[model samples]
Target chain A: MFEHFPQRVLVNEVVTRDGFQSEAEFVPTATKIELINALSTQGLNKIEVTSFVSPRAVPNLRDAEEVVTALNRNTDTTYVALVPNERGCGRALALDLDEINLVMSVSETHNLANMRMTCAQSLDQFARISAMTAGSAMRLNGSLATAFGCPFEGLQTEDTVLHYIEAYLEQGLHSITLADTTGMAVPNQVYSLCRAVRARWPDLEVTLHFHNTRGLGLSNVLAALAAGMNQFDASLGGLGGCPFAPGATGNICTEDLVHMLAEMQLDCGVDLAGLLTQSRQLEAIVGHPLPGQINKAGLRTDTRPVPESVTQLRQSLEA
Target chain B: MFEHFPQRVLVNEVVTRDGFQSEAEFVPTATKIELINALSTQGLNKIEVTSFVSPRAVPNLRDAEEVVTALNRNTDTTYVALVPNERGCGRALALDLDEINLVMSVSETHNLANMRMTCAQSLDQFARISAMTAGSAMRLNGSLATAFGCPFEGLQTEDTVLHYIEAYLEQGLHSITLADTTGMAVPNQVYSLCRAVRARWPDLEVTLHFHNTRGLGLSNVLAALAAGMNQFDASLGGLGGCPFAPGATGNICTEDLVHMLAEMQLDCGVDLAGLLTQSRQLEAIVGHPLPGQINKAGLRTDTRPVPESVTQLRQSLEA
Candidate 1:
């Protein structure tokens, strides 16, 4: 309804990759396949199926290859995977993924802390992967981790982020994601950054990935939307936390984000009710209460009857 | 740096009233007094200290009179109390309150449900309160609960809200709060309604009160701020919820709200670090963890050293 907010936005579900990665115990392959299949039909624009990292590093996603093999793929929804390095990208190349996402942190220390590589090494890896996937059917999307701020280094500069975006564009990556890995983003900062990025590259695809660690996730989303972002990465049931930041909420929730979009009367095509139902299933799968609010507080349409106390008070007042 | 947003915004803390009102156990009179006293010194522009409702109705706030009397009065802060009817207003008039807040719901059903009175009856109560406070120095603030939407009646129209606001103004209330009682507000709706309100009543002191139930709390605040609001009501540690909406989050957290405002570099005068410390005390008082995120994640300035794993990865790469 506002000036700059696009009528249509793309919701990219990152539950399986980001959400499940934080689980203390392994989620079975069959269960993962079932969830992804169920979500594929729910009108999500894309699903980050899994991350193609070493099993020893992230044992929770040890079945990434198998999960990719068995997806009940939907033509309407593109399937994607997070590929960490050239070796991971090589594995994704063999898969039936529509897109392979290459990620690096905008912060130097966070790149070392998260990917065990310097920002330079990660850029080199993205270049090598871009060349490797040159002839492949799969497309590449560069994800900048700690694009807003770094937990180890505090707030990163906008110039640092812009330099990395320039590097990603050089690699022929059409889509780029601004990842708030630690949820340190403020709305004004989000608006300023997104406006700059959109102004610089009008045709480039930009997706916003936010964490709810500090409860600014959805606010940051609103700011980005107003600043001309139309693609977002959200975790189903509000799952995922960085391994370094224990007990912190990870991503903007899929159901909550969709509910807000629908409430704003934006034509973000995802079924809120279906996502709410899936959030329950995810809670059972993860064996804990999710951080998502829509699942707990039903949609605005879910009207309630008058409480007995209110009724009793009304009767007393009349008397 | 953006247009329309004022350099200085007022923070109104509502923990002792809204936050403690939902507590299953009665907080001791001394503890409530202690909390209120501590918050007064934290540079908060205003604080909804307690409600003048009946002890029989809200047993948790049975010590409302005691809390009001015990506050270490701060000249820099305005102390407020929510009074439902003439009798409650009468009790507040006898106290040392800076402001007596009159509350009602814009939604008809919610008005009846929350106050055990119709909208007309609530208006009559506000008129009675205005007359009661005419000779006294106490200012009156009209709080329109469910101003955004009603739990029992779905989405409420802005016209419905403006109608009640007009009635509230007729009673001589220069200040009013638009309360999202159940967190049904979307950013666009907030922006639209707030813009209209500011345009019509340029001199009215408007405060935005939001719940984090649907995870749109902070987003709604940003929208209202952009729409020309300069004051807000937030609870400490995010402690408060509608009794009807079970398992729902209540108001936007004081700490998180201040944290975001500080991060935006806005000239909101509250000390964020002090609120963070108080949140820990609030947790201890409640005997459970509250929903606020900043308390757990720390501030963006809270930087960590490089993790051991990252150090090992660096050493291996060097070797």
Candidate 2:
């Protein structure tokens, strides 16, 4: 089973766009730029810098253009952004972005609730964006939120996700992300679904976005890895959460994912120490402690000295 | 891969014993007894009620004998307690404990730190306890703390654990627990070690103890499960952390573990809602939010109604 792992995995950072959007108090554009600049140089494969959504809908990310424009973008890191409609996609295309993540939900109820549009309507939006972006160098990622299980609906079958993937392919998108928008995925469910997705589209690039709401995020990551998934979406300092799913936490922490990957001896290519430093900075910027555990508990190799009290007790016992 | 799972995994609850032992405020004896009584009836396979160590050392569980004597223990649940030496074993033998966990550390430094003794000395104590428990029905579980990793030392190899386990069998101990004392375990290490342990001793009732320090607790559980492990030790409300490992959190949460298992459709045989209730009550008793996520996040199936805001937005869009 350990042999099943690839030589390396790709970790796509989504903190600036997905993480910051969830915060009610808007982060300053400069701080967003500074954070992205710091993280981009840390060997991350990709960074979703900002979103081109309506300012009225997501006011926090109103400075999408400014953040992307002001970025001290690293050459090695691919820059990405989330786009919800034709206008958003057009905004993303105008920028020097490497990828545009078009978002939707497989569950009709979730699609209606999250996007205020039916699944069919969202597909139409995607089709229009794809038609306009034809022959463009910018990549497109069709992110299916609640691909695992929906809060409004229940568990989603692999077939349900595949059905959405079919539509995604029909719209000319080559890459897709199965987002556990509410952290409703279990290990076997993720393994089976990821296996099914790979079996259907061997050439497709699949990224898994998980929430630690129920604390199964990393476990689901392992399941995905077993089923030949090498791409993941994580947030720095464990930022961003599903506002509709009251109890759901944020995206899986970027530093912690890197730490786990490093421990497993899989090459994630991210500088974990740099990520942890940024996570600490993120805490100060967010004005609250984030959900990441590795930042709290240092690396496994970081061995602590035996406490003075324990040493004295041991000495006394020996005496 | 899914077919490798057992019909049901045996979850051993260790809140009252391991969790409360780390609490700064000593829980009142009655509260400890009440919590134990409440949890014993919740379909748990076993419950480690308390530690029979010197009251002066673990002041929180000073009323170990009293708590054990007073428990309204259910017939269906096997009652367990941690016992370190001859005296603690003697104390447990006088009570109604179904199993007495003989604790030790596979690493030399940890044994000296935690038990104020060397590994050899701890083994000698276990031998003495084994001699005393001869002809007794009370089962003994050799718990190898730092079996996965040590805080003062570092990552422990499976060989070191196997060496200690071999000694345990020599002392007539049939069951063993591989404790990740500082939550340093990764999935491959866990899977590899668990596979090694199972291969060496097929019939040994192996129980895995994990911590969420690095946030790989459940991920490690998935590894152990893949390695054919069916017994896990979890703390209610995610109580009981590594005192030596500064930022490390508590044990793998009982409710969260059960939630993941139930989601995988693996029979954990735990009452989820009942555990949630106890976890909430525990929070009130401990006077703080616990490290557990399920209590804060709720189960995946415990979906919320579509928010009135989302509904209004959808309605306005439709109109």
Clashing pairs in 1: none
Highest DockQ scorer: 1
Superposed model 2: Cα runs more than 4 Å off = A307-319, B307-319
For candidate 1, the per-residue lDDT at B212 reads 92
RMSD of 2: 1.9
Which CAPRI quality tier does the interface of model 1 achieve?
medium
Off by over 4 Å in 1: A307-319, B308-319
Worst 10 residues of 1 chain A by lDDT: A241-250
The digit string of per-residue lDDT tens for model 2 on A1-319 reads 5556668899999999889998989899999999999998899989999889899998999999999988887889989999989988889888879999999999878888888888999999999999989888988899999998888788888788999999999999969999999888888999899888888889898899998888888998898998889999999988888775555578999988999999888998888989988999999999987888888888989988777877787678679
| lDDT string, candidate 1, B1-319, tens digits | 2577878989999999999988988888888888888899899999998899988888999888878887789999999998888899889989868998888899877887777788888888788778888978999999999888888888889998898899999988868999998888888899999989988989899999999988988888888888888899999999997765678788999999999988888878898888888889999998878989888888877888878888788889889
iRMSD in angstroms, per model: 2.4, 2.5
